[model samples]
Target: MTPAPPKNFHTSNPETETAIDRTIPDFPAAQLSDEDKYFTHHKPPSYLPDLEDEVKEFIEYHQRNTHKRIVLVTSGGTTVPLENNTVRFIDNFSAGTRGATSAEYFLENGYAVIFLHREFSLLPYSRHYSHTTNCFLDYMTEVNNKVEINPQFADEMLIVLRKYKQAKESNSLLSIPFTTVNQYLYTLKSVSQIMEIVEKKAIFFLAAAVSDFFLPQSRMPTHKIQSQESGGKLEVNLEPVPKFLSRLVDNWAPSALIVSFKLETDNSILIKKAKNALDRYQHQLVIGNLLQTRKKEVVFVTPSGENSWIKLTDDQISKEVEIESLIIPRVIEIHTQWIENK
Candidate 1:
């Protein structure tokens, strides 16, 4: 069942009482008055499926049952909408191709994937999650091959979609499709809450070119805006969008190996920028994404000074020419090794 959208803030919200005695107990403080109005007026959203208590335990069971580990994978790009109504948005160059292709690789490696993707042009693996308390996975040693086949490298994903068609008859995954920065924030917060509850070490990909800033002062317009973008510059107050790395490492999934991305404009300072990211988030690796080009980039800055500066440059102008082929393998190597270290 879809839950109601978060509540509107008021000075006298009874739920805010942080006293020792309460049912829900210690709910987060209300947002700034500005955020209060901005969020409440918007429609509430449903999330992708969560693991049943039984399913979560089953993941644990699979870990013990098979001795292989489960890792969470999140990808895709975020959106920043222009209006309270998300009809129009300022989009980024991220097409979720990197994230989707990487996810396919992870699935091919036989790891359970807890995908938290946004605007993924590609689809995810099946919904028939195995037994676990709030988890989804399937393990096979001499696994059978009836899982179907298609363009997707991850047969699991293909099977899952077709299965969803059979089970839900075209019901889509819980896509909290957000176009505004706030809308993305709202959805991301819920994702953080759930990830925090998860105990395993996960592999999170910050492939999404999350907007650095968002409308700070959003209010219910008495009338709808005729246009979202204008020729001239009209400034709007904005707040920082949430970054999952710091919070995820510090509080949410400390055990889960972390891999982050850094997008740089200047090539000379790319490593410096990546080092800053490593210091900022304390991640194991950072994929440096150069702006404005899709050619296989200077893939560097993994672990304490170790890196792959190999340039798989593009010549022909097809989609594959612009994307990273070894990106997935390099990530798989680092994560597999990281997990082995632990």
Candidate 2:
């Protein structure tokens, strides 16, 4: 049963207002493009220096293997904070299933993976255990004063564990966490720039469901919004998030194979939007999927105006075959051709 919310849960006492001024400031128009203005005004995440250092170290570790391929897999949904202190925020429905699953396949195919994902979202190897109906502890049993994997789950668990161990032993997988859209954009730019040394050997698998709108820092309230302040009404005005795919394709990781995802509820416009994104950003590929059938099928759109569908048969779906198992191999095939042509 759900407990009732506390009284005045959404309101604050009028007399208890803090000293921080809540005035909305006016600003003059700027000549800068929305993308330029966004990065210019919004401060980078405080942990960016450490993140850059970590990425650089990861890349340097793999630098000795000139034939190695690296894929940056962005995953999960980005949050749009409503206030500077962030008591409330907006989020999408993505659970990072596609990205996490694809990362595992990429690792299996011998490509180094940079898994940039939302905090607490599903990850590649551990995803098999998390976000499931069974509790993680349920997969274990105690016998003879020792904890052991339950025989029922041991077979599958062993396979995932072995793969996870191999990835760790080889240091082929790097995980980066981001929560807000701002952090994701900054981290993506920094990581892509660092990956520039690899040239055509890198792949940017942009699967993250980024927010299309955001509450700008300059406009965000300093404190949690109070219902009493507005007489039980609240209004929020969000600014359009600057599209950074062009910057990513043109400036950051220019020689890399950039594959972006296009998710739509309407199937009719899915291919159109996917193709448009490729033409606009000049990216290598776009994976289009319907919201309802994403797990069963996906359409690949390339700049050459060729489109193909990858789908799971009823038998495959019933047997729990993941579409990413097919998607990753096709992406690798395209990447191989792309590298040779370059």
Candidate 3:
């Protein structure tokens, strides 16, 4: 059976913008499912078929004639809706910094990437400037009826633009978007199953901050929930999301090099929880990080006991060197070794 929900669930109204309660209720014995029924009953993201078709074409192209490796990089945070119409929802605090940055490094290392990310989240190449305080518009100016990059930002923009164009022209990056958790899971399964052709050469970088609990569609009200109707207090019962990592490791893409991230606020339990996940899922690697220090440091846990830490120096961080710059190369090295041993 799946575990209980995490302790961070809350209820809020849009107008007041204040959380009334953060107490998550435990599931009644009757509400629990023996197996993960999340994918079974929830209506899929409507865009699943289109995303699958795009990925199918992308994977087919990569499988032929070229020795290029393929990777599925999942990024950003998935939403847990409170209602069928989704007036309110629970969200994670991920901007997809790791996944987006890592995808860029993978592309730099000659890997074709399938970037499956939260809708409107950060992306490779464009990610540098897209979600930052100084966005694309801030770096551009209108010059003689044509929009041109400002002279101050031109040099860096040129490098980014060239890399983006090169990836596009080479057909090296295929981006698919998702908003809700159901969409993420369904699309992940489809993409992983489709990637069976590449076998061990395929890498699954599961970096998305998936929600731990969600109100099932069956239980969610069909319309927007009214605060007045509910006696001015809102209570929600969220079910534990199924452990799909087990399915991904044991069934979905068994031969693939799978690496997952474990984020916790507490320092004491971070490594322990990550090691536990490695033991449970039997995946290739689990990257454990504390919420406060994730960008500066992460520990890699493996079943073979090759546990190690990766950290960025203050100097490196000041130089604008993203940790992912260090991370992806190490992961590539590990993947190479895995393939060789296999």
By lDDT, the best candidate is: 2
Q: After superposition, which runs of candidate 2 have C-alpha atoms over 4 Å from their true positions?
A: 1-31
Q: How many backbone clashes does candidate 3 have?
A: 0
Tens digits of per-residue lDDT for model 2 on 144-224?
999999999999889999999999889999999999999998889888878988889999999999999999987988999
Candidate 3 ranges with C-alpha deviation above 4 Å: 1-36
**Predictions in order: lDDT:** 0.51, 0.86, 0.82
Estimate TM-scores for all models: 0.62, 0.89, 0.88
CA RMSD of all predictions = 10.3, 10.2, 9.3
- Write down the worst ten-residue block by lDDT for model 1: 17-26
Q: Rank all candidate structures by their lDDT, best first, as comma-separated numbers.
A: 2, 3, 1
- lDDT per residue for candidate 3 within 1-342, as digits (tens), equals 112221111213333222221221232334543223354345545566667679878878877745689999999999988888878989998999889999999999999999999989999998878887775688889999999889998998899989999999889999998888887887887788778678889999999999988788779888888889768898989999888898777766778999999999999898889989998989989999888988889998988887799999889989977888888999999999989988
How displaced is residue 58 in candidate 3, in Å? Answer: 0.6
